[model samples]
Target: MGANEALRVAFRTFGCKLNQVETETLAARFEVAGASIVGPDDGADLVVFNTCTVTSKAEQKARREMRLALRRNPDAVAAVTGCYAELDPEALAAVAPRTVVLPGSRKDALGGMAEALVAARLEGLDLLDELRRLAAAASGGLPDPFSFVPGEARFRSRVQLKVQDGCDNRCAYCRVCLARGRSVSLDPDEALRRATSLAAAGVPEIVLTGVNLSQYRSGGVGFPGLLELLVRGVPSAAFRVSSYEPDRADAAFMGAFSLPGVRPHLHLSAQSGSDRVLRAMGRRYGRDDVLRAAEAARSVRDDPFLGADIIVGFPGESDDDFRDTVGLLELMRPAWVHAFTFSPRPGTRAFDMKPRVPERVAVERAAVVQAIADRGKLEFARSRIGKTLVAVVEDGGDEAVLGDARRVFATSAEYLKLEVRGVPAGFHGSCACRVIGLSDGDGSADLVSIFI
Candidate 1:
């Protein structure tokens, strides 16, 4: 195609941080290939939907977005990729007949796909070979799923960097193992280079995301080493680690928070509070171990934003087991709880487990766990009522400005009409805001004013 006729592309991402990183990488590839990247509403010549299928709801959402994308740009060459595409390509194809379905492992081939689409438009003959050659030349013996080129993400403030890919765990309720193969880390030098560029771009935060981040091991260095290099090396930006397994929460891993730029937040997955349910689910950590990990993280950083994942109403869970989970939540009082009702995945071991919990019971258990989370969050917010927190001002709506507090509440929509304390320097975009009073309805605080 002529320079003026170069394709325009848009990407829509769903699911976890890994998907976000991959979406950024995909956008970079299109930019490098001379495609004009546009926002989802701009209606590009090519629309790429990066999907997730972690839960049934996620799958439905992905499908809904795919349909919407196709409707938005009916003439565009639609492409579907990521976990959802890998798991069910036919489903995606059915939704968008003209859509090109790319597998997760083959996502690196997007650049080649874009090239082919462009060349076919120009030559009006078969150009697949030319596109394939270009991709092979660019890869240069890197793995099939090549690491994304380091670049400033289109969204500048917060960048999701994929330090690792894939998973090796055999969790009974997870199909990630089938969707994404064994674990592998990105080259440490490449990661550092990307982080440096992000810092240079004035991005204040970079989150290290992966299928299983704890399994990061590259070039004779572990996750801790990579974190130390990033935290110490790139002093300009704050770094955050995404979800981690409890077994991976060792002293060295937790110690990275002591570094200047590392944020005090840890999201550990504790599927069940009952020991019996944990064993049945094939999770490594029990109730005690979960509490111990939480305590260890807190010990390193006082009042760190501790978070946990809780799956309620798994098969064979008794009422006492549910109560045990509530007891643990009360005792540990984590900053937040991601409550998910147990759903039997098609290929998972839990699918065939006997004495399955009824759907209604699972829903009720989820509500109970959610109540516990709400109570804990309120308590955490109340504890910080009179303190001043460094808030990263994100969205300034008509009623209030929203940002995360230091301790528990990450994003607060508290009204702005409260008494004035003082607005701190650089308070417009990001600043320190003093907490005056807690919102009576939700746990969000009524900001006294921005601290000067």
Candidate 2:
């Protein structure tokens, strides 16, 4: 088959921010190949469904979305890709027998789906070599997926670059290493080149993502060093780092955020607050280590939002252990908490760990941490209620909100749900918002009064 510009394509992405970035790359590949990328409901000739398999819930959600995509475009060529597809292709093929299934290991080739569809349209044209060539050129050995910059109109509001991939930190609860292999860090020069391109494309924020971001190393330059160089080179774009382990946060390393372009946010995952739980989970850091890291980051900047991931209920967790977690969170008083109950996946040591926490007990523990989190979140937002911060207008109107550095949800640079109202057109570009009312401890934001 040959290329066709008239083809209408659509993408439905699932899972984390990394999945979203891959989905955008897929859309760009199709658009670059002369396909019109459309919304899921817009009736497509080809539809790509990106799946995630982090949790059982995520896997089930991906399956549901796959079926929905098939229904949405009855005539569209179906394709499934991402972690779920890689981890369980057979189950996926069972549901959608004719669907093109791609796994996370081959994510670099997602762009080829557009070519495959076009080649299918051509009469008697063999495209095996062409498809392989296209995939390799776009990704393959050194996949620069985020470097595909189309235009400002088609540009992603946020550009995500994978400076690192895979994980070697065999945390007892993780299946990512099996699916994504060992870690591989990106070269710094290439990373800088990609960030420059995204900035040139008018991407406002660039999120540096990885399965194990702290593990990034290339040519004697560590993740922090690479970040320093990128900040100096790509000053046009603000940079953000995804979830990292607290052990990697050191004085000199955390000091890199002093660069003006690096967003003053550190999303470090402290799986459990108890040292016992941390050892059982095989995580390298302890409660004190995480606290020290948080303190270091906060000390470097003006109240940079320090968010964390905490697993509430793990195997063999005691009441004191849970309380220990709450105590740590109270001490850190983080801007946000990504708290969830521990999930047991097969092929992990934790799967066979003794004395599993009962589902009911786990749920209750999650609630306890959640309440702690809610209070901390609200207080964090209220902390900035009077300070004027540079608010980047993400959208406008009743639901319109603004973001700033720290990049949580930021106008406070937090994920605080503050509803915006009466933002005049003059408030459009280069605007500043004074911290005003915060949400009422619910997901809904407070009624935005004015642009103080």
- Give the Cα lDDT of each candidate: 0.72, 0.71
Q: lDDT by residue for model 2 over 1-452, one digit each (tens)?
A: 13433667788887777677677777878777767788877877667778877677777887787788778767566667777877888877677644766666777666756656565444333334444344445444554434433332365545578788778889888877777778888789988887898788767677788888889888999988988998889887778877778989886578677677777778879978899999999999899999998888888877877888889678999999998998899888887888888888777888898799998999998898888877776677777676665544453343334443111232323333444444554343223566566655455553132454
What does candidate 1's lDDT look like per residue over 287-403, in tens digits? 998888888888887677777899987888889999889888887787779999887777889888878888899899999889888777667667667776655444233332333
Q: Candidate 1 — which residues are off by over 4 angstroms?
A: 1-6, 32-36, 39-42, 115-146, 153-155, 395-430, 437-451
Where's the lowest-lDDT run of ten residues in candidate 1? 406-415
| Count of clashing residue pairs in every prediction | 8, 5
Give the CA lDDT, 0 to 100, for residue 400 in model 2.
30
TM-score of 1: 0.83
Error of 1 at 134 (Å): 10
Q: Each model's TM-score?
A: 0.83, 0.86
Of candidate 2, the 10-residue stretch with the lowest lDDT total is 404-413
Stretches of model 2 off by over 4 angstroms after superposition:
1-5, 119-153, 395-430, 439-452
